[model samples]
Target chain A: MSFLSVQNIKHSYFTKSTAVAALSDISLEVKEGEFVSFLGPSGCGKTTLLSIISGLIEPTEGRVLLEGQPISLADAKIGYMLQQDYLFPWKTIEENILLGLKLSKRLTEQSKSASLNLLRQIGLIGVETQLPKQLSGGMRQRVALVRTLATEPKLLMLDEPFSALDYQTKLKLEDLISATLKQFNKTAILVTHDISEAISMSDRVLLFSPGPGRLHKVFDIPDVIKNLTPFEARNHELFPEIFQTIWKELESFETFKK
Target chain B: MKPSKNNADLLHKQYVHSLKREKRKVRLYQLLIFLLFFTSWEFSSKMKAIDPLLFSSPSKIIDLLFSKLHDGTLMENLSVTLIETIVGFILGTLLGTLLAAILWWSPMVSKVLDPYLVILNAMPKVALGPILIVGLGPGYASIISMGVIISIIITTIVVYTAFREVDSNFLKVLRIFGASRFQCFWEAILPASFPTIISTLKVNVGLSWVGVIVGEFLVSSKGLGYMITYGFQVFDFTLVWLALLVIAVFATVMYQIVAFIERKIVKE
Candidate 1:
């Protein structure tokens, strides 16, 4: 069975006067330890889909399964990261990182040390006692990453986590995250609008079209590019060829919408 | 480069000095206004330019304060009013927050209570004073109930709004962790709303004072409110002024205490 499977998912948001369909007939699967990206325009419900897979939102007409069990039942096994760090400003970095473990009631001395070790491994050292406001944007986001990873989730969801950072920081974080995920042999699904980001970091890029977002096309990154770190992949010669193909496919959706 | 660094340090010192000077000037102006108002009132009363009977002199009020203190009547009344105000203030805040938590816990409850909340918040709370005294009897219970009722509705409305206004994303983070509703409230919602809650506390200090005083007025019992009423009946405005002054000082002190707690609890 696939590591994570989203089956014929459909969702809608309802208000007093309107029921807006956000996602329609969405189905996808990711192999164990695979990396995939959902590349799409705004209003594509990329986030909506991510929320569904993370079990934060229930699909109106479908289900998600992780390791062959329903995703909802697999509590605390999925880690979700948002565009901005959303670290509880009142909490110290240590508190924020341990939040997941604390919530899951698995916070032991061993687990605490393991999370702190992860923090240090992620190049954030000696910042455990400091508050989120004291850190720079990149550092805070890294703290958020540590917070998410502290739970040791089997599958990770990255919803445009690097989109809020400066270009330089974003590039560096992509490499750091790609390496970390690879080192742990974890499966990850990233949602992004940046063609280069999707092509560089993902093994397979799933292009989504907007307006009740449907999967439009899929592009499989060559092993030559996929084997490299995101930064190295971005600089690879084959990168532009794949980038152009995905960009044109995304552009077609815009023109077709208009 | 060293000389330029020294210049920067010198400029920083000058800026700090200017800030201190400005703060001192503000304090000086505040003292001047306070002194001028009382000094003018005392002078006018002494010169018989104003009705001494109606607008009692500062000296007369101070003398009455001393005499009342010596006889222990002022302490008795002041303590009664202070206790009622404090108890009422704490109860009002606690009940309001509890109501807000209930509203947050169940959206259906909030929806059902929405119109009622608006109505209670809009209605004059003091108008319930007579009814409270009649119902709870002419005692501390009625006076304290007045204090609570006066502030509770508004506190509920304000606190519930604050609870709702907490970033939905924070709740999202907690939900993804599979945290229960109670866990979410304790971990994120309550801590996030501390500032708003503290601000409501500040406003409730004044509100409870209004409630307790009016309750005392309706009941005609032992309190600063009763002192004011008695002074008015006897046409001894000095006694009225003394009671008013005491209320003002204690209210200010309560507000400052709330402010201090806000500074301590709210880091940012």
Candidate 2:
């Protein structure tokens, strides 16, 4: 049994006048410690698919599985980092990072220490007293990432987390995150439209079609950077080639939309 | 090239010069404008250009203030008025916050209560004085009930809107984490709405005071409002003016306290 599995999922939205089909007959598997990216054009429901897998939205058909059992919201073990950093502006940095822990249960002294250590590891030493508004954009996203990680979910779903960042900061965080995920040995699926980001960040990339989103193509890219961080993956020769291929997929999908 | 006392004098002169330069002339302007206003009123009253009894010179009002101060009853009545306002304001704010939490918990309850709350708020608080006096009796109870009626409604509307105005994304964040509804409220909604709620309290201080005074005017026998009414009936316009000024001063001070609390609680 694969560590994570999604099978024949279908979903739709009903407006007052029309039913919009977002996903159709989607099936995929993610093994332990593998990183996957969902690449698609705009309106392709990639985010919706991720949302469904996490059980934030109920899929209209089929099931998602963790270890071949039907995935429960409790058992799904996924942490989401959204496109925007939804940090509570009123909370201090330490409090913000501890949010998931606080909600789930009271953190023990050791666990709280570990969270502090994680914050230090994220290169934000002595910033615990600052509020979200005091931090730069990059720092806010870093705190957000740690908040998700603090939940200790087995599968991390990143919903275009770095898109809000500038180029330099994005590159820096990609390195920091990639290294952190490796050290922690996490399985992750990232939804992004950036071809280069997908190529640089994932072991496999699943490209989806727009609207009634279906898997258009899948690329096996483990060899691009065998056990290296996302920063190192950029230097691999195959990275650019994969980037071009995803770009073509997007172009064709747009044409299909038209 | 010895340093002389003249140099010390020059430094002192410069310091005084800078003090005068920095201290600003705005208060002087205000005092002058105020005196000018009353000067014209005094001049007009002397000339019989306007009715002396109606316009009432600043000097006459000052004399009235002194008389009331000497009597000590004005301050006692003022204290009574302030107590009603403050108690009512605190009660109203607490009730409003509680109601907001209830609404956040169950949207349907909020929806059902929505129209009724609007109607309740729209009803003139002054008109309720007779009914309140019948129910709660004719003193502080009626006065506080009056303030509570108006201020609680203000708080309810302000806090409810603030709670609803919180970014929907915060809700999604909690859901993604699989936080239960109550947990979501504790973790996200409460903290998010806290600032606005506190600011609403600051805003309602003045209104609540207005309510208390109006309540006192209708039925209170020992408050500043009561004194004002008594003064007006006895043709003591100066006493009435003194009462109004005292109420204004107390209300402003209470409003400032609310503002200070708001600054303390609101992070950004």
Candidate 3:
């Protein structure tokens, strides 16, 4: 059985005047420990879909299933990190990292030691004293990632987290994330407009149609290697092929001006 | 030839920009203006156009200030006013900020207190001067109460507005983590509201001064406000001007301290 399942889910928003459909009968299955990417253009409902799965937004129709049972939002195991780091500016790196644990009331001495070890593994040692504002953009995002993952959710949602960074930093973060996720053995669903990013990071990239987004295609990436990071995979012979396929898939999308 | 001419013109413009007065030079020019202003006022009073008794020549006001300083009266009065203002300001800010937090913490509390607050705020707080004196008696308590009345309203309004204006996007992030309300406030609302809080502090510094001075005017035997009133009754224009100068100087100094604190926090 799939670790998590979304079966024909629909979502809409009513703006006091009209109902606007955001997701039109979307369905997908995420296996245990799978890295999934919801790839689409800006304004696509990939984020809205992710939100529904994360239980931040309620689906209008259909049900989300976890462990072969109907999933309540409260019961949905999700760790969502957004584009903005959302690191409390006042908090130190240690405080910010433990924010999730603190909120979840799971910050025992054992978890504290484990979290600190995780931080060290992620190459952030002695950042306990530094405030989020004091850290670089890349470092802030790292702290945010740690904060999200501290709750030890079964599935992690990445919402364009690296989009805010410049190119070099983005590449560096991709490398860091790959190592951390692999070591921790976490499942993830990444939402991104960046084609190359989706191709590079994800095990399977789910391409979606433009607004009222529905999954158009699912590309099973076969470029898996022993311990290849996002930066290292750029040199793979299949890199260009995967990028081109997803590019063509996106370009074929119908564009009608609103 | 046209291009060369334009380049020459550009070079000239750049040269002029480089030669433009520095910020410190602009400050010097301001000082000069004050000196010129005082000199002119002294010249005018020296002339018979306005009576020296009525206009209070800058030189005479300086002499009056020196004499008051020598007598230790100016420092004594100023210390009393400063203490009252500081105590009142701190108390008002603490009360206002706590109340704002309570309101933010629970909608029920906010709803209950809102009407009463509006009515209290709408009434001229200055009108409460007599009541404050009656309740607190004819001492520094009356002045501190007045200052508190003025400052607490501002602190409440500024903090309440800031409290309500919390970023909902952060709330969504918190919700995803199943964060409680207390945790959300600690992590998100408090830090986000800080810039607003600092700005309110700066504004309140001035308002607190206004409150203290007004309080003094209502009832006091010492302080700059009292001195001004005494001068006004006895027809000592120079003394009145001196008192005004003292208040303006003290208020500006306090405001600068607030600005300094803001700078430190911003750096942090």
lDDT of 2 by residue, A122-151 (tens): 999888989888899999999898988887
Q: Cα RMSD (Å) per model?
A: 1.5, 4.9, 5.5
TM-score (0 to 1) of chain B, per candidate?
0.97, 0.83, 0.87
Which candidate comes out best when scored by TM-score?
Answer: 1
Mind giving the per-residue lDDT tens digits that candidate 1 earns over A51-143? Answer: 888988889999998999998723789888899999999999999999989999999999999999999999999999999999999999999
Candidate 3, A86-163: lDDT as tens digits: 887777888878877777778899898888877787778899888887788998898888887777888899999999
TM-score of the second chain, cand. 1: 0.97
Candidate 2, pairs of clashing residues: none
Greater lDDT among 1 and 2 belongs to 1
TM-score of chain A of each: 0.97, 0.95, 0.94
Tens-place lDDT per residue, model 3, B61-104, is 88988998999999999899899988888888878888788889
| Cα deviation of A53, candidate 3, in Å | 2.0
Residue B69 C-alpha lDDT in model 2: 78
Candidate 2, B170-239: lDDT as tens digits = 8887776677888778887888888888887887788788788888788867888888788888877767
Error of 2 at A211 (Å): 2.0
lDDT of 2: 0.84
Model 1 residue runs over 4 Å out of place are none
Q: Model 3, which residues run further than 4 Å from truth?
A: A62-77, A223-228, A232-235, A239-252, A255-258, B1-31, B39-49, B57-76, B102-142, B161-169
Superposed by TM-score, candidate 2 places the C-alpha of residue B92 at a distance from the truth, in angstroms, of 1.6
Give the clashing residue pairs of candidate 1, or none: none
Error of 1 at A244 (Å): 0.8
